[model samples]
Target: MGRIIAVANQKGGVGKSTTAINLSACLAEKGKKVLAIDMDPQGNTTSGFGVDKNGIENTLYELLLGEAETKDTIVKDVVENLDLIPSNINLSGAEIELVGIDDKEFILKGITDKLRRKYDYIILDCPPSLNMLTINALTAATSVLVPIQCEYYALEGLSQLIHTIDLVKERLNKRLKMEGVVFTMYDARTNLSLQVVENVKENLNQNIYKTIIPRNVRLAEAPSYGQPINIYDPRSAGAESYRLLAEEVLNREDN
Candidate 1:
C-alpha cells in the first residue's frame, strides 16, 4: 500500500502548500508514482501544478460529496509522474455539508483506500485550520507532516495542533503518526530564525527534518509561474533544499 501523508499545519503561511507541491514534485522526479490531493479550498496546490482551480470540473468537492468517481476526478501527468486531485472554491462548503453525515471523518480515508495500490505516495495538502476537512485529511492519512516556519509564535500554535493529533490517534486513527516536522522560511542572516529552530527542536524533540528550507525568492516566484522549484530554477537554493528533503524522506523509509 502507498503511504498517505497529510502535509498539515493549522497555521497559515507556514509553507504547507509549498512543501506539498514541491515535495510531491521532487519525489515524482525521483521516479516515484505520486499523487497530490488538494484538500484546501484555496486550491493553491492545484494551481501550483498548472491546473486552473477555478475552471476545473470533477474536483475534490465532487469526490467528497460522492458525486464523482476518483478516476474521473483525477488529473493525470500533472507533472511527469505526478497525478493530482484538484480542489476549488467548491470545497469550502464541505465542512458544513459533512456535519450530519455518518462516519464523516472516514470519507477521505475510504476514497484514498481505494487509491493506495496505484501510487508510491499520496500527499494531501490540507487547509490552514483544524476543521472537518482537516480532520478528514488527518483521519485518512497514515502520517502527518507539519511545516513550521522559523518564526515567533511557532510553538504556541503547534501545541494545539499536537493536541488535535493526539485526540485523533486516540479516537479516530490509532495508526496515525506525526511523520516529522520540516522547518521552512529559514533566514540564516536573522538571529530570530536561528533561535526559533533551536527552541522548536528542544520542545518537539522528535523527527525534525534536517533540511531547512531557506527564504528563497525563486521558491516564492515558482508558484506565480505555475511550476515547481526544480522546473523553475533547479540550481536555486529552494530547489536544492526540496531535493534534499525528498532524499531524506526516501532514506527514512529505507531505514
Candidate 2:
C-alpha cells in the first residue's frame, strides 16, 4: 500500500498548496508513482496541474458526496507519474453535506484505500482549516506534513493543529504520525525569518526539515503558469529546494 500523507496547515497562505503541488511533482520526478488529492475548496492544486477545475464533471466533491468512484474521478498524467484527484468550489459544500453521514471522517479513508496499492505516495492537499474536510484527510492519512511559513504568525494556531492531530490519533487513526515540519518562504536576508525558524525548532517537538524553502520569484510564478517549479524553471532556487525537500521526505520513514 502507498504511504498516505496529508500536507496540511490550518493557517492559510502558508504554502500548503505550493508544497502539495511541487513536492508531489518532485516525488514523481524521483521515479515514484504519486497521487495528489486536492481537498481545498480553492482548487488551486487542481488548476496547478493545468486541469480545468470549473469544467470537470468528476471531482473530489463528487467522490465525497458518493456520486462518483475514486477510480472514475482520477485525472491521469497531470504530470509524468503523477495522478490527481482534483477539487473545485463544489467541495465547499461537503462540510454541510457530510454532517448527517455516519463515519463521515472515514469517507476519504474508504475511497483512498482502493487506490493505495497502485501508487507509492498519496499526497492530500488539505484545506487551510480544521474543518470536516481536514478531519477527513487526517483520518485517511498515514501521517501529516505541516508546511509553516517563516513569518510573525508562524506558530499561530499550531497548538490547535497539534491538539487536533493528537485527538485524531487517539480516537480515529491510531497509526497516524507527525511526519515533520518544513519551513517555507524563508528569506536568509531577514532576521525575522531566521528567528521564526529558530523558534519553531525550539518549540515544536517534531522533526524540522533541513531544506528551507527560500522565497523565490520562480516559485511564485510557477503556479501562475500552471506548472511545478521544476517544470517551470528547473534551474531556479525554488526547484532545487523542493528537490532537496523531496529527498528529505523520501528518507523520513527511515528516521
Candidate 3:
C-alpha cells in the first residue's frame, strides 16, 4: 500500500501546495507511482499540473460528497507515473454541506480507502485552514508533512496545528504521525531565517530538513506555467531541492 501523506499547514503562504506539487513530481521522477490530491478549493494543485478546472466534471468535491468515485475523478498528469485528483472552487461549499453529514471527517478517508493501494504515494495538498476539510485530510493520512517558511512568523501558529494533530491522532487516526517539518523560501543570508530555523528546532526538536528550498523565482513561476518545478527546470535549485527532499522522505522511512 502507498503512504498517504497530507501536506498540511494552517498558516498560509508556507509553501504547502508548492511542496505537494513538486514533491509528488520528484517522487514520480524517482520511480514512485504518485497520486497528488488537491483538497484545497483554490485548485492551485490542479493547475500546477497543467490541469484545467474550468469545465471538468466530478472533481474532489463530488468524491467527498459521495457523488463520485475516486477512480472516476482522477486525472492523469503530464508526468508518466503521476496522477491527480483535482479540486475546484466547488469544494469551498463542502465545509458547510458536510457539517450535517455523518462521519464528515471520514469522507475523504472513505474515498481514499479503496484507492490507497494503487499508488506508491498519495500526497494531499490540504487547505490553509484547520477546517473540516483539513480534518478529513488528517483523518485519512498516515502522516502529515508540514512546510514552514523561513520567516519571522514561522512558528506562530505551529502550536495550534500540533494540537489539532494530537486530537486527530487520539480521536480519528491513531497511526497518524508528523513526518517532519520542512523549511521553505530559505534565505541563508538572513539572520531572521536562521533564528526561525533555530526556534523550530528548539521547540519541535526536529529542527528542519537539510534540503532547505531557496527563494527562487523559477519556483514561483512554475505554477504560473502550469508545471511542476521538476518539469519547468529540472536543473534549477528549486527542482534540485525538492528532489533532495523527496529522497530524504524516502530515506527516513527505511531508517
Candidate 4:
C-alpha cells in the first residue's frame, strides 16, 4: 500500500501546489514511484507538471465520477518515475454533481484503493478551500501536509482547517492524521517572517518542518514555464530548499 498524503491548506498563496509539484518530483528522483493527484480545480499541479490539460481525454474528474479508472486517467509525467492524475476546470462541476450521490466523500478513496499498490506515494494537491473536493482528498489520505506561508495573517484560517480535520477524523476517516506543517516563503531578513514562524511553532507545538522555503522569484516563475523549481533552476535557493524538504520528509518517514 502507498502512503497517501493530501497537501492542503485552506489559505491560498501558501505554496501548497508548489510544494506538491516539486516534492513529488524530488521523491521520484529519489527512486520512489510517485503519483501526484491534482484535486484543485485550478489545475495548477496538472499544468505545473507540463501536462496539457486541454488535450487530455480523461482526468481526475472522470475517475472521481466513476466514468474512468485510475489506470485509464493516470499519465506518466516528464519525470521518469512520477505519474499524475491530472485535474482541470471540469472538476469544478464535480462538487455540485456529487451532492446527490451517496458516500460522495469516499469517491476519491474508492478510486485510489484500486491503484494504491502501484505507487510508493500518492500526493494529493488539495484546493484552497474545505469544499467537497477537499473533503474527498482528506478522506482518501493517510495524513495531511499543510503548507503555511510566513505572513502576518498566516494563522487566520488555520483554526477552521484544524476543526475540519477533527471533524473528518471523527465522522469520515478515523485513520486520517496530520503529517506536519511546512513553513513556506520565509524571508530571513524580515521580522514578520520570523514572527510568523515562531507563532506557528508555538501554536502547533513544534509540529512544524525544520526546512523553511524562502521567498524566491524562481519558485514563482517555475509555474509559468510549466516546470518544477528543481528543473527550472537546479542551482536556485528555492530548488535547494525543496530538495532539502524532500529529504526531511523521507528521513522522518524512516524513523
Q: Rank the candidates by lDDT, best first.
A: 2, 1, 3, 4
Report the C-alpha displacement of residue 82, candidate 1, in angstroms.
0.1
Which candidate wins on lDDT? 2
Clashing residue pairs in candidate 1, if any? Answer: none
Across 27-137, the per-residue lDDT of candidate 1 in tens digits comes to 999999999999999999999999999888799999999999999999999899999999999999999899899999999999998899999999999999999999999
Q: Against the unseen true structure, what C-alpha lDDT does each candidate score?
A: 0.94, 0.95, 0.91, 0.90
Q: What is the C-alpha RMSD of each candidate to the true structure, in Å?
A: 0.8, 0.7, 1.1, 1.1
Error of 3 at 139 (Å): 0.3
What does candidate 4's lDDT look like per residue over 1-255, in tens digits?
888989999899999999999999888888989999999989999999899888899998898888987778989766779999999999999989999999999988987776789988999999999999999999999888999999998998898998999899999999998888999989999999999988888787536778899999999999889888888999999999999988988887788
Candidate 3 ranges beyond 4 A from true positions: none
Give the Cα error of residue 90 in candidate 2, in Å: 0.4
Give the 10-residue window scoring lowest on summed lDDT in candidate 2: 246-255
lDDT of 4 at 39: 93
Q: Of the candidates numbered 2 and 3, which has the greater lDDT value? A: 2
